[model samples]
Target: KKKKKKKTMEMSLNLASSSTSNSVFLFNPILSGKQLAFPCRHQRIPKRVKPFCVKSSINLSGPRQTLSSNWDVSSFSVESLSQSSSRLPSFEELDITNMLLRQRIVFLGSQVDDMTADLVISQLLLLDAEDSERDITLFINSPGGSITAGMGIYDAMKQCKADVSTVCLGLAASMGAFLLASGSKGKRYCMPNSKVMIHQPLGTAGGKAMEMGIRIREMMYHKIKLNKIFSRITGKPESQIEGDTDRDNFLNPWEAKEYGLIDAVIDDGKPGLIAPIGDGSPPPKTKVWDLWKVEGTKKDNKNLPTEQSMIQNGYAAPE
Candidate 1:
């Protein structure tokens, strides 16, 4: 009689394990075209003083094993791809969105530069609706960016159906930092390594000093508009908002919490139910401009912002 080959069942488990040094481990898999889109799932992570794993893997090959424990696993996830079907489910429909129970909040990081408003919106759209009901955490790590762009983000975060708790990772400076302080309703927090800043919008222009002087005047007017938004969210007075954003203030994580910038300093995951900031209000008004502003450039009257539904704001795309 031939000895039968031993059979074994295969399954992957995701555990939230942390180290005394604040090291974390995270593993997940994405399927594509009946194949793993990126076979090498191990992603090179940014080196932090605390060793932490992420959605991908990290390098543990240093001669000096700085980390107390090296986590390695072969089985991650085995998902099947459905082919032969006439049509398929779009990633937008099947993605993870509101995983409140899972404590898996999606942080768009900061749109300081390349991280544009559109990119963050698209990412949120990919989240599955089921996850929307779950507590959605935003792990913000940014130093603020465009004034107008930040407001666009503020509108998005302020209107989340999911429970959003923002935890600052690095520096939430300028417009980026202020938005977080105001946008989070229930649990606003920061890491020990985080910092916050509020200042006037600064930009470079191509013009003469005389023209530059006029530009500064226009920018200052817009400065008040930004201040109002920050003050409304932070519950601060316009007087205080203007003074802080006037290049006269910089706040570390400690100063941020003291000044109502953040709610708490959480070392790890927070467990509880948090009400959403607010429901979806009426659509924002469009900012129409003189077509003549662009020399001979025609405007698409049909594709105006007023016509576009709030769904197109990058939250969830219409099927």
Candidate 2:
């Protein structure tokens, strides 16, 4: 009996040692007593770890949600941009009033096209309506263009209430010379260095021979009319005017004055007096006030001689 009891005790001790060899023990300084632990082949526990948690209001029964009282977003808009741009001035705001006022000078410096002729006519009529008694000056610096256009302007000048004074600044050729010659008798003037040219009217015709012949006839008629006008103005014979205008006849200011195309050659030294030509004799030294001096005396000023007084004084009208 004693031997069997001893054998049972030995077997119990061996089982306890085998279980201890299969188990693991972890030493945790935080724990007061030793805790039993199991060894895991596939899982591990980290030495330091932090807990993750979400906070909430005291009420926990209702659904969790968030609400924002204020929110702002910025973006570009076309209306706002247009309103900002409208504050700037446009191209049409440019002022031309001062320029027009300073230079009462009318410019005929381009080709004598229909548009140019119309503009000149309208401007002259406006000036005439503005002040009929004041002189209107027309400055010509053209190489000449449409004869019909030039004639339109010329006729308007003759009919306008104001006296039209034509001044040639540069080359007054072809139709330009015609207009220059048609200025108010004593008002036609040319700069000393300008050139004047006159030539027969020109035209281009095509189609049937009859059509071309008709055009030729029309051109001849115009030529005849122009000869008459020139003769009347320059006191030259029609034949002479025809011969001179047969081809391009270019003349300097002095020659223009000699040909009666212009009444005077503007002298830089004498502002308003007519400059003399190459002839030995001096030109008539007339003053602007000479024409009005008699009228001025007629007002009983006695400061000058009246036209009647001049007549009584044997001073005949200047030749």
Candidate 3:
């Protein structure tokens, strides 16, 4: 019965190809049965078998076109086909925000969950790898989420050799504010009306008494670490950061600058950090904070600070 079935399958394949030179053969006959057997007597038929597809191009009315003898069946695999389709997808049609990524800009507009943080971290790393001397602009408007995830992104930013310039759009709270402060010094900026809020890490403890206690301790450690990070970024005393972050400290752009959370408040007439390519002016110089070397890492060269007279305060130095 097996011999008859194999003969029938071979005849069918032969007839299929012989019917028309243009007809494409689209399947392998050997693996058509319930199980695939090998010629070796010791080899047994596997319980499962992978399907294969074979194709032959047909010439319709036009001139004959033949595939190269070097054509590889592996190239027509389902996985390869899917990957090719994915590569051809339109970014705009897919609604992927690749335009900013192309410009070395990463937007943290959503909560800093694992997915969001991973994407931002990857973009930062990729952009840095592309051009270590170029600045990576990070636009942030997030309420924040996941301290661990945010820390991962923060570490990635610091790990990059390129500088990161953070911009605050609408609001930056919790871990968002931490990231805003993590940008290269003298390069951080906030929209004129934007706000920044810094506070101790918030969390809920559950499960068991021991688990609750452990979680609380971990939160405390994170708070201390955050305070140190802010102190280092803002050039403020750790005590000040601790007190300020004890509760929700909301600061407007100017107040944020005063609090050392940002370097400047962007307004009209401000050149800001968005410089067109091929512009005669050189790219702004920035300082990258190295996680390994925390002290004396400030850059002496910085672009001229854009001045805006403070209405509330009589006179304030360039922030």
Find the candidate with the highest TM-score and give its number: 3
Model 3, span 165-215: residue lDDT tens: 999999999999999989998889888768899989999999987798799
| TM-score, every prediction | 0.48, 0.55, 0.58
1 or 2: which has the higher TM-score? 2
Model 1 / residue 284 / CA error / Å: 45
Instruction: Give the runs in model 3 whose Cα sits over 4 Å from its true position.
Output: 1-96, 268-271, 274-319
The true-versus-predicted C-alpha distance at residue 169 of model 2, in Å, is 0.9
TM-score, model 3 to reference? 0.58
lDDT of 1 by residue, 1-319 (tens): 1232121111111111223234333324554332222122344577879767676455566554421123222211222234334445454334444222233456656465545776655444434244556555666777777766766666666566665667777867776676667545667877756677778888765588678778878788778888787677677899978755655366656567677877655533333233223332222333452234232232433344553465667654345
Best candidate per lDDT, number?
3
CA error at residue 231 for candidate 1, angstroms: 2.0
- Each model's C-alpha lDDT? 0.57, 0.74, 0.77
Stretches of candidate 2 off by over 4 Å are: 1-103, 268-319
Residues 1-319, candidate 2, lDDT per residue (tens digit)?
Answer: 9998678667755655666655444446676542323342333565886888989758888654321112111212455447787544333322232233223446788899999999888878777776677777888999899978988998999998888888998899998999999988888888877899999998998999779879989889989998999999999999989978866878877778889998877763423334544433323435765555446434545565679988888886454
Which candidate, 1 or 3, has the higher lDDT? 3
Residue 160 in model 3: lDDT: 93
Report the poorest 10 consecutive residues by lDDT, candidate 2. Answer: 67-76
